[model samples]
Target: MRHYFSDIFLRKAVIALSGLLMLAGGAAAREFTVNTISDEKGNARTPVISDTGLVAWQAYSLHDGDTPVHQRVDVLSAPPNTRRSDIIIWQDGKTNNLTATDTRLTGRCEQPVVGGNAVAFLAWFKNETDLGMPFTLSIPDKTDEMKQMESDYPTLFDPPKPPPVSTVEAEAGEAAPPPEPETPEAAATNGLNENLQRQMWRDSGQAADIVYYNTARGQLERLTSGNRHYCSPVVSDAGVAFQCARGWPYGYEMVAWPASATNLVQLTTNYYYVLHPDLHGNELVFQGWDGNDYEIFRYRFDTGQMEQITNNSFDDTAPVVWDGRIAWVGYPTITAEIFYWADGALRKISERTEDNTAPSIWEGQVVWQAYDDTDMEIYYFNGRRTIKLTSNTWDDLAPQIRDGLITWMSYVDNWDSEIMAFDLSDNIAVQLTNNEFEDSYPQTAGGKIVWQTIGAEGSFIQMAVPAAAP
Candidate 1:
């Protein structure tokens, strides 16, 4: 008889062995001190530290209190399997509760640890009035306790490393000549090496939200600048599409730019809000308000013609296309539904129970984010069946599917938001970021994932390439 081990069992066994070894070796317990700083209003901000020396602090919300809201400071540390304690260094002002009357503020925490490794940190905030602003978390570097944790817990770390160079043939008696340089055609054909061909979009130089090729070289390009606006950006082989408000009464309009350095083209001239533009072949599909209600629309690139795909009164958004099919989120009545258009007919992908959004089509599968009892989770559409990918009680959204992988942002209760990727073929969801800071809006293309992260000064984009398989 042969005994088989499941992946769960193997992972638990490895963790158990590592813990036993660490205890037997008597590894020195590391100590961490967490410090928080608020704008001016003495609002409390959460801060966290990982064993790898990664430190991150949350940014207070602008609706919580006043801009220069009160600033409070605290320190916390504990050893492994020991009780943690917190010390308040500074405290001021009574906590406010109301939303309209209350002033929102922003704050951050900065923690440092010795030894180069990745560290994980936890933070907590106090809001006497409304639910506090959605907390943000970050990790400064992959050092200290975080590094050790990654080494000991291989399942948790997914660091990207360069692909190995292949050895070339040479004359046995002749000196080995330098390897031939890659031709442009060969580089372009290899999707992973087409970083130089990728285009970027930004609003302005100082804007917070930016979208660009994660693996592309050169200076960080701004997609949109001026005012904290713009939500999501979708890029295809021909152009880049995003939501902007340059000439609209509302704060959003679907816009696109050619792959080359061409001017932006406003796809929708509607005065109402428009969002979530996706490209399929020669058509641009998006969701927008047609003066009365939200609906799906498609614009042809060559014909300069526009058509409505969905005419329902409820809101419909998050459109994706692949293999001559269109998948999107539709509000049939009260519940949000997933629908797909194929063979001159529209079919509901889900059973019209869960609220689904952020649909992406890849390799004949439709991937989306669905709401459950606790938080949002990822789901996959396979022709006639739907499968749940994650069961954690955390908010996960903005799933981007490409090349058999699904990447998204997940928010844990005690940890900052992280960029996680799952391989559909292997059924393994691996976390690619462990920072105490927030990492959200994950977009994957050509094996690389890019997202936005909040830091000490402002927000910036972070890119991670997938590690080549052994």
Candidate 2:
């Protein structure tokens, strides 16, 4: 390899600046530190960490005395799991509180996902605004009502007076309230990355629409709407892919969009439902029902080529794609086991399936939750062999991997949980949190971990990193 002076100088400078130095071919041993992102007044949970060290979370702040009435989401840089002091919650720019108050905020926005550019969620808004060209529900005319009544009725002469109109019926066709001018903070981060394609949802139980936020152009473009449910959206640098349902089984089809929702692409519109899309540049992998059973499929964006990954008579689900390799749960013999697909070949990763599920892959390495007959443990795979990483009786679930760092949740119970991480470089897995609090939904990326912990005060997001970095 040719050595350039500027490249060598920059490499040294980056090592000095980030305080991270690695040996030639061995893994580096790292101590971990946890950083609190939100606490006290509100709860911050559902955080996602990007491979570049950026973190975003959804929080409910108790702006009032004890009620967490102020709901918002925030994103900040936490490369080394640095604690953020100047945190600002981002909300829709509608100043009339429609986005905050009147809308029936559902779990649609509950999925707080982050990628390279911005944080996205399912924004459930079901208020007067989205009700569409409103109409009055006026009482029937006096003469028309009297004639409609049967002559046999003795009370036909005495017309019943109309009761008070309901708040919803009365406000029909009412103009929306004027919004406040752009606040200094709102204008700054309104559409942080107007070019990055983001998937979001607007579900109100009765009605919903799946949409994508165009970061480069700052537009929330709708992909599908009208009496339907859509979810589990995954996006790559190329486009966004999600699953939609139109009630029953017709709605669960895999759909895609490039930069704008207007350029909508329905990858699968068959009778079977396609769910849980995993998108990684130029490739989209998901599992869908193929008439009789569920199997995994992959689609190439550049050439519009589609291929079935698994053909067995089992349910292949929850696939996560990284680069080109894919990992998912395959239910062979009805016993769920971790499986992988690479180089046109599908193979099982687990030695024996005792209910193994929730597999995630990064650069061909896999991690998953498995039950070794009695205890629930998280397992790891090095693309060659499999090993049980944890031997605890306590349940360790939802293990994620990135850059050799593995993270998962250790729960004594549902509310009493902890975030644990293991570094492949040093072959050391340490409990990142050990206290009287609830920490779960851990994700690993860029050699760092992010998760949420709920205490008496409120739920907060905490990040961990190898403690050697300054």
Candidate 3:
């Protein structure tokens, strides 16, 4: 019995020791040194890593004795463990070249050091009467000891191999293959034949406020010209409505043009500013500003009669009609509020604390831009309750809803503004543009979105198509 117990205890000890050995072997760390090829001038380069961890580099060459030469080189770095370095070269008044070299340099020390992982070596020479270009790098493999260390860690010094060349070809006597034909579904989805969102913007050109049209042709059409100052163009199947301002105090006269006619019919003779004209069936809902305040008004095309919808002393604007309700922005107090005209009664939707503007009604929900303690954000009211859509600290405004999706423009940072869309049902927001330029005032209709892109060339309308359903 004592011998059997000793045998069991020894087996247990052996099993515990083997488990610890395996754990230690798995935890052992690895060190690697990466080497890159130098240009013809013996200048090595470093690599650029993307957000996805992929690396890429371009090849460059040097000239020797007035003759051009070529060579292949690559930039490399460790996966994600250490700080990556960059190389920059300046010539004349501009940056002529930028590269990442294989040397790591220390601060406050100009001379190169031996046996350091990061060492920079600089070379300077004169060409004829001109001063030679100066080169600085960090990874100097000067001695055989450092060279042997690079050889032991082959991965660090291993250069990227060239892509394999293909030699397979079609037979000499074989006929060329026929081109593939397009499918009906693909043609319909990709073709520019469907109706898209159409809105107007003021171009700060000689033709101040031009009636801009965004169509299926993927281009903007300027309809009016020369000092007319046409603004606020809204389109429907029947026609387009606009406010043409000419003189002081920005006196605007409401006008409508049939889709087939070039001439516009002056709908209102008043010199007040009329804006935010939306067409529903044959009726038009717009906001007209007298010398004092703004009021929501409606016009019946068949009857040729204009009637005021809200007779309150507050400012009401941004009228959007959907599901037999006209949604607009009304300021009962100092804060801008949201109100909808339904069943011949006016009902307020948003809370009184926040200032709401740019209300759009679609699919039984009212979406608008509101400001709380922070910058502008988007909020939606579904008849019973209001919910904030975005929680970022930046400004997000100009909410437009179409086909069960809410599209808005958000400033991700001080310099980056993007167009984003959110599916109301699934509560999923998708970033559409990741550009550095400012993209704002996104309006969606049907399967497309149009926005104003503010870049170096000034503001212009840009369009984006929605992804097809999977």
Candidate 4:
């Protein structure tokens, strides 16, 4: 009887040890609330986490008391988020005093990117416009254009029919000779740049500008002024660079204001639909629409010259650049692929034809969203091998990588989003958040993760730590 009891006890010990081992091997995730408000109306989105466990995010008033009315999309549907939005900072598990609600009136604060000791964000100045300006489109010779149009007009037909015959320039097989050098005005009026048309919508009011927060000084400084609407401000120790939204058919252009200079310099103004810019040091890379299709472009701030990295007619966009290399998503057909550029050569990084996009780069590695499964999955490519980070049925999208660590948003059972992280070294994919509500746009650097979430009660900026170390 004693021997039988001893044998049972030994079996139980083995089972308990096995359970502990399994628990240790599994990805362990924990949460830390970075920002919460008294009203609990702060709906935060797109929080950036740094290597030192510092987090910055943009939050808008949940206005908890106000009845939720389908969340506004149109100008008339709701007030500008700027009025309710502010930037929040979280450090050492405590919400910091650094809030970007410096404006007294209703305004917006968005896309807070943390780099080193400074946090760069997007902010609207209520009635204030940006002082620095972007380059304007060169005006064409209207008088000459008017005369040409008058001469080219055909006699009106009963039904305004097409021209009876092809114009001299339109004759097939015999192409028109390229025009000789002309004045800038005449050239501007010419259709040479007709491809640079604006394809996106324009807002009624002015756009938001970039604002920099000095965490060390605890001071907020406006980096850009009323010139144009800017998006995705990438900051390095050098300074800040972003895409400025120009009027339609022109789309957005890359612009920058160096730390040494007060005036904003237009990096690209020639009409291409430049968008989705990322910068590292004095080198900048962005995707642009060259009339017929989208292509990736690289620009050097010191040299003031830009190179067309990808010339294909397919749409290549959402480029991320670092250490003079770039990666972007290229859509050849309905589906998309990943493309990378390095050392003056560009190559297809992703061979899959399914929809893949929203690429981010770290060191020399690249990460993107791949729609291989029912929901989008995260993929990582380090030039040689492509690895799938997540295989869940739910969508995992908007991946960002830094130092081989990847972070993104994923939707699970209830369809509400959660923040996830994958450490490349350990190959452990950790679900950072298992929130009942939706959490999204997580940014990870080193071992830290930050994201935004909103529920019926309110909105918030959340963080996951020790994330800064891995």
TM-scores, one per candidate:
0.47, 0.69, 0.48, 0.70
| lDDT preference between candidates 3 and 4, better one | 4
Q: What is the C-alpha RMSD of each candidate to the true structure, in Å?
A: 26.5, 16.1, 31.5, 14.0
Best by lDDT: 4
Return the TM-score for candidate 3, rounded to 2 decimals: 0.48
Ranking by lDDT: 4, 2, 3, 1
In model 2, how many backbone clashes occur?
A: 12
Q: Please write out the lDDT profile of model 4 over residues 30-119, one tens digit for every residue.
A: 222233321244455666766666677766553334554225433124443523566777776466635543653245567788766568
Please say which candidate is ahead in TM-score: 1 or 4: 4
The whole-model lDDT of each prediction reads 0.50, 0.61, 0.51, 0.63
Worst ten in a row by lDDT for model 1: 9-18
lDDT of 3 at 120: 20
Candidate 4's displacement at residue 248, Å, is 3.0
Q: Determine which window of 10 residues in candidate 4 has minimal summed lDDT.
A: 8-17
Which ranking of candidates, highest TM-score first? 4, 2, 3, 1
What is the model-wide C-alpha lDDT for candidate 3? 0.51
Task: For candidate 2, write residues 1-470 as lDDT tens digits.
Answer: 12111221111110110111232235544666566654544556677766656565655432234334223223232233222222122222111111233224442344545555433445554442443212121222334444455353323233342333456545755544545654343335556432121111212235544434434545444444434565776665566776766343133777676643245576775545678887777788998898678898899877889998888777888888887899998877768888888898778899764889888888999999899886677788888888777764577788889888888887744347777766667665566676687788998778878787776666766667566654
What would the TM-score be for candidate 4 when compared with the true structure? Answer: 0.70
CA error at residue 211 for candidate 3, angstroms: 6.6
Least well predicted 10-residue stretch by lDDT in candidate 3: 107-116
